[model samples]
Target: MKKITRKKHLEMRLQSIPSHPKPKVGLEQYTTPSVIASDLVWNAFSLGDIEDNVIVDLGCGTGVFAIASALMGANSSVGVDIDEDSIALALSVKDKLNVDNVDFVVSDICDFNQPLDADTVFQNPPFGSQRRAESGQDLKFVKKAISLDPKVLYSFHMASTEEFLIKFYSDNNLEITHIFRYNFPIPKIYDFHSKEKADVDVIVIRAELK
Candidate 1:
């Protein structure tokens, strides 16, 4: 398909996905904007490394990463999440984008099996602050990705969690190559005061498997 047609189709698919106030179990309900999606797309595309290599996005909220990877010429892309609603929305977006190179599945990261040899993996996991009791759940996703032998681009909370994530990556034999920092604006959750406070920053780290 022509690039323009593909672009328009993706735009429509993005519109189809439900925004905030809709809940997806095991996944936070942050409606990522086009700018953030583009940033992730560029990061993941840069890690393509080889032409037609496979890319996967763990906890792919709405399939933006997968969609962008397909557009950037990855041989194939897959997005895995436990949220059925998210899976449905992502599939709809794929149809609109006319991107047949990408697909999505509903599954938890811990229970996943590496069905394909992925050259790169991208992920935006939960900060594990809101409802998750564990403060370092994000690292599990990265660890699992590394175990699958894929270079990863992972988003994390830019607070003290940065140190924890760095150490975890190092321990797992993953090398951090680049860090993209941004102030992430989060929504006001139920009875959460800091939810509106801009105390939280975000960092996207690019890491390679050893």
Candidate 2:
């Protein structure tokens, strides 16, 4: 099968998400959802992931996953997010791609309309609460993915979250298919002027929907 890739185009879009109020500790920056999405997409495609599969991307910050799915020949790809700006940017990219296989919607993952037809889900939910300071937000996303009963689910999370996440999903009956670790660049405000940047280790978890 032929592979497709879309270039990142969210210069203005990134500006609209609103900068973090304070610097993130350890890593001064957080990874962009697009990078996370691309990493997931490449890995998924390498597994002979699926052709004409229904794919849903939750917390699709920039729609890279959604667009890549459509490009990869998924019968349908939908990206869902709570942020209006992010959704708008994603939609814009969707139009630019001119691929009818994908769509974007603005909604929270928990209450968003479920794609009963999807066989796979690709997501990069907030690694933690980061700006919001909430713990275990990844669990909420995992449960939601299982609720869809996809054959496979891919997610990017904090490396430190591995043990906690592994136990959490194991308790919930989800099995870890694979785990990939890499240095992830996190973007955040630094110093009094909020200009410094930092990179940290991030682990991407692949789990089978059992």
Candidate 3:
């Protein structure tokens, strides 16, 4: 099979991948749109973070980022998620596509300690929009990513929290290298959704350990 070299090709591959069967609102389970995922993965690849590198995607919903990294020439990619259903779907897609460089594990971010020494950490974690109890979920992912001590990290967050995230990263000794803004499209998946589709402002932060 030919490698996925272009962003469009990568997006096409990801477009067919299935999403969670029953998305949980509290977990903020929304599939990352193919266009956004493609842009983020291609940008990381161009930054020398994906090709020939080991990557880990925390809170990986259906393994979009991890699988993309594998397709883009990562030496290996691991996706960890708390949802078993999501992991199962990700594994099925990996098998159907015959992608051998990526693996998916069902584990909560808090309990995940697999001795990972990844070169890059790519994650689209929960933006903490739904449940009030899960407000700081993104911060947990950030702290865990930092614990892995990767050379680079790409994390998605609500654009409104940019200032807070800047301070948070500074306190954690992580430097924000770049921030890419995107209008994330959220389809009405739950009963509480007021619109058929809502565009949310999000920022993908590229950070490095200081």
TM-score of 1: 0.82
Q: Which candidate, 1 or 3, would have the higher lDDT against the true structure?
A: 3
Off by over 4 Å in 2: 1-36, 129-132, 189-195
* Residue 209 of model 3, lDDT score: 97
Candidate 2 accuracy as TM-score:
0.79
Which 10-residue window in model 1 sums to the lowest lDDT? 1-10
Q: Ranking under TM-score, best-scoring first?
A: 3, 1, 2
lDDT of 1: 0.70
lDDT measured at residue 112 in model 1 versus the true structure, 0 to 100: 86
Q: Flag regions of model 3 displaced more than 4 Å.
A: 131-133
Per-residue error (Å), model 3, residue 78: 0.4
lDDT of each: 0.70, 0.68, 0.91
Q: Across residues 1-210, which tens digit of lDDT does each residue of candidate 3 receive? A: 578877898999989888688998778899999899999999999999999999999999899999999999999999999998899999999998889999999999888899867999988888865545368788889999988989999999999999999999999999999999999998889988888998889999999999
CA lDDT, candidate 3, residue 14: 88
At residue 186, candidate 2 shows an lDDT of 52
Error of 2 at 77 (Å): 0.5
Clash pairs detected, candidate 3: none
